[model samples]
Target: MAERLLIGALKSGKNTKIVTLNGKKMTKMPSTLGKLPRLKTLDLQNNLIPKVCPEISALTQLTVLNLGNNLLEEVPEEMKYLTSLKTLHLFGNRICRIAPGACDGLQNLILLNLNNNQLTELPQEVNRLKSLTCLNINYNQLTSIPRELCFLEDLSELHLNYNQLICIPEEIKFLKKLQKLFLVRNNIEVLPEGICDLKKLRILDIAGNIIQIFPPRFQDLKLREFYCEENPLILMQPFAAKHQENIWSLKEITSRFVLNQLAEENPFLMNAIEHYPEVRSIISGGKNCAICGKFFLTVWLECVQFVPPSKNWKISKNLQLVPLRILLCSYKCFNQRDPNLFGISQE
Candidate 1:
């Protein structure tokens, strides 16, 4: 029936630039499609097309192709020859794999949607889409993102939600032009620190993960909206509690403890301890000394003693002394202390 309709359309004019056979119950694309040399847009969505017809590649002038909601097992490599193609939609398909060179000559492509597919990984040739501005691969079985994806310098929005990703690659910082990033509902345990370098980023959604800490400089970013709900995040609790919203601005995080706690838990700081032993020593020793009121970098001692009763105090049957502890930085400071003056005797 689809072939008959196309034959009728071709009989009217051989210079047809658009063909719409959507929902025509097409089990296979008719070879007669190759006869339209001036065709520019082809819509075969909601059809039963099991595979792409190799003859379709003869339509070099085709710019928009929609084969969504089909039974295609893979993307045809010959389709890459459609150099004038600008938009390709393969969503809602049974596609399990994309051949490596399947997108080699698609230099003019701008948008590619592969959402709701059975794909586990993207082809390396995807990086060759230098003109691509938006990519949607959500609701797939992707375990990881390819590093080559960061090479899409013009990409502004990326959707990877509802996947099995364990961690975001640090190379994501390379997406300098990225404005929005969607990574919700993954098994990600930690957010990569390099994400803080996205100067143009405005929205970041990492909800439903096991994130415990943010990047040390996360508060310094110019993000307009942030979402981290349903995660076991400890440092972001105060902000979330005060805002009472799933998405909030970074300016609302006014607590000093947030930065302090992040610095203590930062993996980069821990890694730096290996190269700077003195910094490790100071962090391990103590905070400050009671005698000199200076930071400690070496030995320190803590002394606990109970307060003694004074002459002005009234005698009570159930009185108890409270204990106080003092930190001494060095042995010399401890030796010079006057225990008797503090109401304690030293043997």
Candidate 2:
């Protein structure tokens, strides 16, 4: 197709400001695209383009660049000229070497997608993308990440799944804004200290790795999802989590919700309760039963890894709530109640 016609199609009108020509697989971008001076977004994905067309640099107003699923071998040095480009998607490409000073001109880049490439190492120039917030580099040939990457201060989500990573950098703990971390299917060994100090981390997915000792310190975390499956992690340190009555995985989940009615009144020992709806009709936090010596229904709470716009989370219901350990005393047995001895209240 003629380049002028394509640029004419990628125009703005009224309140709209986007144009798409995705999956075109054009070996060459139209030479007439520079005519669309008002263009703000460009999507040219799933193409067979062997190289990043330098003509793209003329579109200085571009904010989005989608050249994914193409046969691209290297991003053109001219790409640095698109300083206004913020989101660049180049996943599933034949890229082997990122041009040096690649991130130098991208002063406002917020999102970068370079997954599924043949990259053996990342360019140190990546640290220059100061405004970058999210990055996706899954299924690559990376051996180790640069330690200077700690400079991505505003980065929130980092996806590095299916890489050849053997160890996590200690400076990674410095990414205070990191919310989600996906470390699945790697060759990592030990986890570093203060790994749990990422107070804002919400989703931590390290499944299918060689993890040994999981940190025994997660009490201060406001976690909502925690997945360490397929690792050699042993028992969770119950005491380290400050569980008052029952064994809790972490702290935040303590008596947050209480179910007060019991169906069987005296639930069978070996038969575990299945789902919540089974006890839904019961009144919550109302009365104690004579047989169970506590509230009729059970109460439970769970945790979630509290990471950021990160792409690391287990697709599981990873909630760990410990039930209150109540004394099973008969009313007649309670007549002989020793409040001080059992720490019971008989007011």
Candidate 3:
């Protein structure tokens, strides 16, 4: 029956650019599909196909392929030939792995769906899909994703919900065009401060995680939507009597001294940065205290300030208080902090 359908579809015309073979119980792809060289879209979803025939590679002009809800255990190696593909759906499959280089030729792929699969990790080669704008791999077994994915500068949306991820790399800040990010139901404890660098991020769903507070300047993001329910969020407490002396290690003191000199463009330190990349790296790691405006390395007092979202922002109704982190260079700086900023009780 499947063969006859393919034959009839072929007879429809040589210019047939679309074919839908959904719900077909075919165990394998009909070699007849190779005949439609000019086909731009093929829907083989809701099928029992356990594997794809090499004949699939002949459809070089294909732009969209849907192979979801199938019995496939891995991404077909033949996919590399679909160079013109813009959207590929392999969701709801048993796929646990993707053969290396299977995505090498999909340069124009804009959207990819691998949700509800068994993918434990994504291939580093996925960075090769330079044009990918949206990638969905939700409901997978991924414990971590390749930081190389952060290099996909054009990616606008990323979904990693229902995974076992403990933390995302700070490199995620490189996704400058990212708008919506969903990391629901993961094991994330603390979000990276770099996440605040994504200037275009507008919607974020981090519900069902164990996050305790937002990173500093988190409220600065012009988010239109935010979901952070079900987490053990730390609440701002009434003013408490907390006093601790600021103790700086010798390394911290020396690094701060060097950083100050570098800021003043000291000839020796400035020249060292030119010849010693490690020295440049250490200088780059310097962070300014929120209160004192002085550079500090490693040792700083952490505090939190509650910020309410602006009227235009849409956040969870239960989320009344947003904790914005603050780093102070010393106890004196902490004491001079704004009245609204509260120190986290170490009790």
Candidate 4:
């Protein structure tokens, strides 16, 4: 019966571009599907097909392919032939592995849905999908994603929910165009400092994680919606404490002096830094005092300031105040800090 339908479809027209054979219960893809060279859309979802036939790769002009809810165990290598593909849906499959070169030919792919699969990790080749904007990998067993995934600068919406992800890469700041991030139901304990660099992020869902505190300057983000539930948040207990006197180590003293010298852009020191990569790295990691504006390394005072929710923000009504972590150069700066900035008690 499926063969007859394929034969009839072939005779339907010479310019036939769309084919809908979903739920046909066909166990194998008919080789005749290759005959539709100009086919732009192929719908073979909700079927028992175990794998995609290599013959389908002949459809070079295919733009959209739906193989959702199929018996596929892996993404076929032939998928690389669909260079013009823009949207590919493989959701609800048992796909556990993707051929390395499978993404090599998908340069124009925009939306990839790999949700509800058995994928444990994404291939580094995913970086080749430079035009991808929306990638859905929810409901998988991914514990850690390849850093290459963060190389997708055009990505705007990322769905990593229902996974075992313990942490997001600090390189996530590379997705400058990212707007919505869903990290719901993960084991993530901390958000990277680089996350604060995503100035375009607006909607964030970090609910159900074990996060106790947000990264520094997290309140600077102009978010419209914030969902942070089911996590153990620290209580806000405003109190007054005196900054204790502390002695600086020899290494700390040298690092502070070098950081100060680098700020003046001394030509000789700048050239010497090129030879000592460690020095350059330490200078880059230097933090400035919030009160005195002095650079410091390895030694600083940690504090928190409460941020009242803005009128335009759509935050949970249960949240009246949010704590933003801050760092100061020394105890002296902590002593002179604004009355609102409170030092976190180590006791």
Candidate 5:
């Protein structure tokens, strides 16, 4: 059998640096492979290996291990001894769990692929790989991303598509060096405004979701490839209609039409524009807080109706319809105002 020949060859070459037995239909790894203590690359992809043998730890010099397209159910904990490992490919497997300490000592790892598996959650220990730069966990059942993943400050590329994620955490902004991010085909309803802070992001895929709007600062990003198709993007309707093309520019997305569309969709914004035209004029003229007359990067609209005229007083019906609008830079400013006469809560 091919396994017998592979074991014979490994036993004969004790200093073998590379051993490839890809698509050999291997069910189990022979313990004789441990004799090659100098093995640096081992390729056993496209096999039936149910589990990795602990004896693999004897190959302490292993740097690249490929076990893709197999039936592996869990990562062997003994792999922690392979401190020299840099790239591990476990894609196309039935792996549902990873034993504790499986990645505890893998400090030298730079790329890891666990895609197309049944993993529901990632182990917290994966955060220990400070040297990791690329990671692929696409096509899994993950409902949420671990906040601990933010510790990978050196990471540049992260693929988390085809999962069941409902939201992307604000902590993702910590990946300052990230250049590519793929979140296609998820249940994501909203993207945190913090995503606009990823200055190095060039490719952003957010297709196939129910996202209605993007942060006002999103136009500041200098992305090269932006895939937002297939999403129910209601706020970007004006931009989408005008551009008909796949590519988008920052100017087109941040145009007055798009901004006006976003404001029209919000009840509080519409009320402020309709009832108090001065607030709209002030915002359109410049970026200063209408209430305190201070420069601000963020602001909210709060509207309050005037106290109703006394029954004895005579006033036109049209004059009583106007409401006072207050542009606040923060919630504290809005809280300082007296309650509305109509008891309508500030949004």
Candidate 6:
């Protein structure tokens, strides 16, 4: 009956203003919207549409069109007929190209979404959307961004993460109005020198890369949040010279340690002690005998074993022990010791 009523509403020249079908399996909008000549907003979200039907371009009064979360492979060329549109959403589709004239003459377009697609490059025609402010082309197979995007002088927030970008394009430096930039998890080894030019940049994320150093004057910008984690930065001695506000990590690879030629000499010790990067302290200077408090040359880790037990005191503390120590004494000391006490003959 609702379909019949909608048919009567169209047949009687009763113009409709808005059409919303939330959570419905609308594969395509009925051709009635074009005949109304007054329909403005058409929302077709959360549907099982396999592709966008081209007949939607007849809605000349459409100001906002949402087609998110659908199986659309490409933005149809006929969509440019919606000359009065201001906001458009074609996200979560399988689109592979941002065609040259597919979105032409949309002079008032403000917000555009082409995220989560198979797009590898942005066409030069993207620069025609001069009125665009918020643009999201993230989560695609993009290796580099087309320089034409810098034309969106009004764009503020740009999301381009989860792509295979190796470095920030120099054209990106021209976005004077850009506030937030997300370029994490890329193969970048160094940041662009023109980054400080973005005076309005608040959040700059370049984590999970191999960048080991940053500009000395970067703190002059006074950014609110900076993410530079998981880089190959060593001891942050360079950052320690400033006002001490930059957050850094001291975790570096072993190769960062310097090879020092300096040494220290002592008469009591045998060799020249070399300086290591990590050695902090030493407990005892001179060694002492284990049997008595007498001074000795050295103290070593010896593997001693207990002999037979005592007669009355089965486990007396004074039980005999074999001195199976490592290299400390010469052959003369072993040859001169009494065989009865040490249990060792001349051989």
TM-score of each: 0.68, 0.64, 0.94, 0.92, 0.69, 0.61
For model 3, residues 1-347, the per-residue Cα lDDT tens digits are 66788887788877889999999787888888888899999999999989888988989999999999999999977899999999999999999999987988999999999999999998899899999999999999999989999999999999999999999989999999999999999999989988999999999999999998789878888788998999988897766685777678888988899887877779987787798887677667788899968888888777888888756678876888888778888889888889988777777
- Top candidate, metric TM-score: 3
- Ten consecutive residues with minimal summed lDDT in candidate 5? 236-245
Q: Which is superior by lDDT, 1 or 3?
A: 3
Pairwise lDDT winner, candidates 5 and 6: 5
User: Model 5, residue 28: displacement in angstroms?
Assistant: 0.6
Tell me how candidate 1 scores on lDDT: 0.73
**Superposed Cα deviation of residue 203, candidate 3 (Å):** 1.2
| Residue 189, candidate 6: C-alpha displacement in angstroms | 3.0
Q: Candidate 6, residues 1-347: lDDT per residue as tens digits? A: 22343475476574677767655776655555567667788787667666655666777778888888777777777777888888888888788875557768777888888878888877888887888877877788787777788767877777777777776765676888878877766667656645657777777777666765443234444455566666553321211111112222332111112111111233323232334323222312233323332322232222122232223222213323212212212233323333322311112
Candidate 2, which segments miss by more than 4 Å at Cα? Answer: 2-7, 10-17, 216-219, 234-347
Q: Which stretches of candidate 3 lie over 4 Å from their true place?
A: 239-242
Query: Each candidate: what lDDT?
Result: 0.73, 0.64, 0.89, 0.88, 0.72, 0.59
TM-score result, candidate 2: 0.64
Better of 1 and 4 by lDDT: 4
lDDT of 5 at 169: 82
Candidate 1 lDDT, tens digit per residue, 1-347? Answer: 76897987698686999999999999999889989978999999999999988888788899999999999989878878888899999999998899767889888888898989988887777889988888988889998888888889999999899988998888889999999898989899877767889999887787777775554455556776667667754321111112122232343222222333335576765565578666454455234556666554333455434443233333233323323345555556656655621211222
Order of all candidates by TM-score, from best down to worst? 3, 4, 5, 1, 2, 6
lDDT of 5 at 221: 74
Which TM-score value belongs to model 6?
Answer: 0.61
